[model samples]
Target: MQLGDISVNFVELVREACHKLNVDPMPVLNEYGVTPETLASPKARISISRFMRIGQALISTANQPALGLFMGQALRISHMGLSGYAAMTSPNLERAIRLWIHYESLSSVNKRGSSRFYLTEESGVAQFYSISPYNEFNYFVVDCLLSGWSALAHWITGQERLLKEVEIEFEAPPYAQHYQQAFNCPVKFGRSRNALIFRKEALLLPSIYANPATHSEIVSICNRELTTLVGATSLTERVKQIITPMLQGREVGLTETAKQLGLSEWTLQRRLKKEGVQFQQVLDETRKQIAETYLKATDLTIGEIAYLLGFSSPAAFHRAFKRWFGVNPKPFKDQHASGRTDENTATGENT
Candidate 1:
């Protein structure tokens, strides 16, 4: 399955790791268009492509190829957003792990039919989906996910060396020795699956933080979000998904989009029409949503945002912004920023 966008929450893990190494992450983050404001939004997502690029750069800068393993050690429940909270309050380790797997999309998205991670409850094994043909670009993804889950399991259940063993799909790399430090358990490579094998009895370990009332409420919220996420498989939604990643530095037209969707141009048009939306409309709407995000959640200049959004020129972007919001970009951004500040202040006072 093709990779999709992941939550900015995961990016924070990288940033925290950089801090531990005394490496400034901003240079790499800015090079990839990740801004402070973007990280501030719990709901914001970074494309998987950009996330990988950031990881590679950070690993190089720190001269630590096993950066993902160390980064996983830094994982905390707070880093997971709502899903973490739900898992923390679960009745036991098994339920907590299941909640994490079930609500995985709250933190990251895989392609429509793909599962990013799974748990074999009966065996107490948790598996991360393989994105093989592993190289410097992607090996860290597997390392971070499996190790991160193990770290969280240990933290919640108050168990040290919680995993019985780790099974990696790929053969050991040059840094194989470091796996011992990351997992503190038997680490086997060239296995059929990438998994963290838990001691069966450990699956019943009670969470130190489990709270029945809180768990119930958070699960309800997660269920609603899951419903909204999975229900968005409409053709228009699919078109937007195809359009988002393609907007990095170039305009994506209907022909390219239909090609990506594996549908002929004419057929794509007919289907979108059947959904009561036009191709250009969907494209513009997608651009508008992304533009709003860049404007509100990044310090990027108008020209920079324009280039990222695939506008022909800054003037073109300004005109489009005016058309979308009925105002020019600068004042509109200021208005929203001020509103956010006020909202934050009010929230603080209430708390």
Candidate 2:
């Protein structure tokens, strides 16, 4: 339960990338204090700084500045471990993207910055953008993310998609040609944003593993993992996780949550106060998050949704929904069904 900052799974990817170029990765791993065991663990992680150091090492060892593109191309959903399986089993590309956004932190953590996806109906495209602190390996991160998206989409949908365009925040490198060729699209460097623009229709493709029954089961598993991830990292997340499932059939309160966490009510209250949160605040936030998901992803009736969230009545749920979102639940669900989404809002970093 280390809840690693970067998934150790990336070690295999880095190794594969180096092997393809006939470069040995042992030196880099040794230099960075990474080990074969670290890479072998499905749950261990390395800090963000160390991850970047390793990425730099991989690039230098391979003698290729565009190593990220190559590594991403070699990645498959199966390589993502549990996170990958969840995405592969999601109903569609869009749903899979949302699920990944929601559960990403269960596998890795991002320190530099997070990523967001914005849909522009007028442009007929969706833009996946990253907000990261400037660093030497920024391009590598961008390349891997964009190319990874392409690769994952292809794997899930059995369709090849060429990005509409790729934007980089830095100047073009000497190997910019490789990027252009790898993405099979125009790669623009020195742009204000690091993003991959794709046609909206591409997100509508059906996943080969799409099954309503399986999707629900996988999501439940993801929720449990997310709970574990937060429990290891933050008290707030642990409480939220506890509140999520319990909201379905029983009253969730500080007393019950504290008991579940093996702490006294007073101790739990004090801990949350130390974290600058109150029990009520966490409960409300958790409800808002789950409410949005149920409205958008499921066909449950408003009354049923309300009951599922442990609200006594649909009217009670409506009142709370309005307070949280400035709109009623029905309208919110309608907007989501119509293809409108919260643009700047996402559950986790793009990775």
Candidate 3:
């Protein structure tokens, strides 16, 4: 149910990956039931299920060089940056996933921090995972995890494909054929976890271009920037992360949130200031998201929604929502409610 943060251009990543595969990825993407257009919107998210189907398919069919080399090429790293370089300096393929997860945002402003790789063991198989925080663009996470790692493994051993199995956590859908193609291995769904399985020998593959110097440098840089990328994990990210969550609730306030995070009022304020945000401003932004989420998704009365947001009065909520989105709650809700349900928005997707 998660992809990296909500901002990454997942469709672009898919397109780039497809480009690397030397086939129009759109056809495959469409086969898995996603349109290139739907994912084009910055705030838009694909349900996790759809994302997995596409990912499974790609991993089954795609070659290793396509996953990294072409994906790197698709992102235009030659002039702008290095997808391969980032993947190369890591200690292992898992570290390489983190590099893509960390520096991914550098290449795409929409890239967020939710996509991550982890390991799991079930039924005696080594499962490497890519997880998402919510349901949006879940396929992107699945695709990247399967294909990206497969690509990295290939790079290490100079092989074509690396995964023994792709263990998907979600239920299998209609795209089994395509799924088989992308992963090029047994694909199972509704499993305990989402992962790629490799034989024990896979881990022993030496990185084709391991470098201690570059590895150290990238790790240092990744550490500093990753803290910021989390945007809600550390003091910096905490402010960003809590902004939307706190706003949606009725009891938002500086002192309350400071207490919740186990910090004194002054300390929280100082930290947020360093991150270029103030308590009141962050509070307003939070309220705006809360206001929008409630307005669009619920039938609660204006008075109730306002009260739920810690607004002293409905009028204040209305005024604030207007400033945040140019239109007030009622109209915003009305417009969204009237629109087709083809695209369901993420309640707390943030930059």
TM-score for each of the candidates: 0.67, 0.63, 0.50
Candidate 2 clash pair list: none
Question: Cα lDDT of all candidates, in order?
Answer: 0.79, 0.70, 0.54
lDDT of 3: 0.54
lDDT, residue 82, model 1: 87
Over the stretch 45-97, how does candidate 2's per-residue lDDT look in tens digits?
Answer: 66544565578878977888888888888888766767787888887887776
Per-residue alpha-carbon lDDT of candidate 3 for residues 176-282, written as tens digits (9 for 90 to 100):
55666566778887776666676555555556677889878766775676566456445644554444434432656788778867899999999889878888887
Model 3 lDDT, residue 79, Cα: 20
**Can you tell me which runs of candidate 3 are displaced by over 4 Å?**
1-83, 102-104, 108-113, 119-141, 159-164, 191-194, 197-201, 214-238, 242-266, 269-284, 290-351
TM-score for candidate 1, please give it. Answer: 0.67
Off by over 4 Å in 2: 1-4, 122-135, 231-351
Sort by TM-score, top down from the best: 1, 2, 3
Question: Is 1 or 2 the stronger prediction by TM-score?
Answer: 1
Per-residue CA lDDT of model 1 for 1-351, tens digit only, reads 123668887888999988998899999887776778778864777666567768988999999998898789899998888889999999999899888887887777643222333446545787776554467877898889888998999999998857789999899988999899889999999997789898878888999999999999999999999989768679898888777666755888989999988999999999999999999999898788767765664345777778766788999999999999999989878877654311111111111
RMSD of each candidate?
A: 10.9, 16.5, 9.9
Q: What is the Å distance of residue 74 in model 1 from its true position? A: 0.4
For model 2, give the 10-residue run with minimal summed lDDT: 342-351
